[model samples]
Target: MDDGGMPWATARAVGDRGEDLVCTYLEGLGWAVLDRNWRCPDGELDVVARDGEQLVFCEVKTRRSTRFGEPVEAVGRDKAHRLRRLAWAWLEAHGQRGAAFRIDVVGLLSPPDGPPRLTHLQAVA
Candidate 1:
């Protein structure tokens, strides 16, 4: 893991870059990338994608290692609530209120080839 930026700053950078890799991964799996960093009062979602008729709200967590637990597990109840609200805002603003949607998590382990993973949990929060 790089240490150029402050702890949080570096981590955010890793996650931001990692989100791009995750988006590419998803796109390869037939998911179409949509809005990225869609922010509202309920925090910010890293990426949004479309799989057929379902909209996917993605949360990206990047870490040097999994010493504590899986990166996606970091998304707790509070964050989930905010993401849900943000999703709602996204829906209303995009005039997609009636469309189907779901939530997903992208776990990115830094250092490029260090076992980056994706755990997609549908319909969260």
Candidate 2:
């Protein structure tokens, strides 16, 4: 398979890097990251953090090139719904069911030889 013109391993590495960048960025903003790559039967939540009284569930999308579309464009209605469900599952599992929570999307465009560009969309769902 073409794998979108990048090997699976390379693609995974790009995504991991994006998540790492987002985590550092969030921490720089004084957000405490509670969990990362949190996975359950439903799916995975890339970065889960606490900002003041709100819990943020962030989805990270990264690409080496925006040949198809912007990274944030990947999260459509279905993906948003999945993130919501995953967030709820995370809260229940951690005994924080009643906590104020919101979904966020972090999009990263990492070119072959340049500083990556990041876009954060808060309260997406």
Candidate 3:
């Protein structure tokens, strides 16, 4: 919602909605969502979830269209590196010591007038 007075209402709305969708879906898959839109010095992680034995840190990318590329392809090397660092911060802050963790990417392709397509990529780091 904070766009620094430069309103990107549609984008923000879509992003928020997509994140909610991801959370719901992940919960159904038995993952406990710990945080949404977590911001650290390294970067922001879209979702921090726990899937049983592993702490799953997720990066979510949603797009109205795949004209440019698939949503999953958006997380490049720099972003991946930042996510790794953020995961470290998350682990340390939660007093969650020495659990196996992995990076996951959830891509939501929400084309207008259709259901959103979600693809989960595991261990994307």
Candidate 4:
């Protein structure tokens, strides 16, 4: 949990837990997770998976509550554009041999009092 500071350790832990859950859910849906927390000079991608013929670059946002806004609301157009660029860089760096590629976002809302809710938005970018 290298969250840059101890104050954010809990947030980091929650995010990590959410990512694990999302990965497991994706696997159950028959998607093979090719990478987790893949990084480059630009930024980091939460997850990359092979869904039959398409390569999916996923951005995951986890939240403990909706006090500010929903998890999906966190990713805006600018972020989506950045994610697309990152995806291209990933494909290029990995040899650009995939069938096709798309950007997706997974929003997780894990409340302390109840079950976590997951929202998978495919082809967001």
Strongest candidate by TM-score: 2
Q: Model 3, 1-125: lDDT tens per residue?
A: 22224358887888788899999999999999999998877678899999997899999988877775778888899889888888988888888767689999999988778999999999989
Tens digit of lDDT per residue, candidate 1, span 2-61?
Answer: 334448777677777888888888899899999998877656778889999889998877
Model 4 lowest lDDT segment of ten:
1-10
Clashing pairs in 3: none
Global lDDT of each candidate: 0.77, 0.90, 0.87, 0.89
Output the better candidate (2/3) by lDDT: 2
Candidate 2, 1-125: lDDT as tens digits: 11287887887888888899999999999999999999999889999999998999999998878887889988999999999999999999999888899999999888989999999999989
Q: Which stretches of candidate 2 lie over 4 Å from their true place?
A: 1-3
Comparing candidate 2 with candidate 4, which one achieves the higher lDDT? 2
lDDT of 4 at 63: 83
Worst 10 residues of 3 by lDDT: 1-10
Model 4 clashing residue pairs (backbone): none
Count: clashes, candidate 4: 0
Q: RMSD (Cα, Å) of candidate 2?
A: 1.7
CA-only RMSD, every prediction: 3.1, 1.7, 3.3, 2.8
Ranking by lDDT: 2, 4, 3, 1
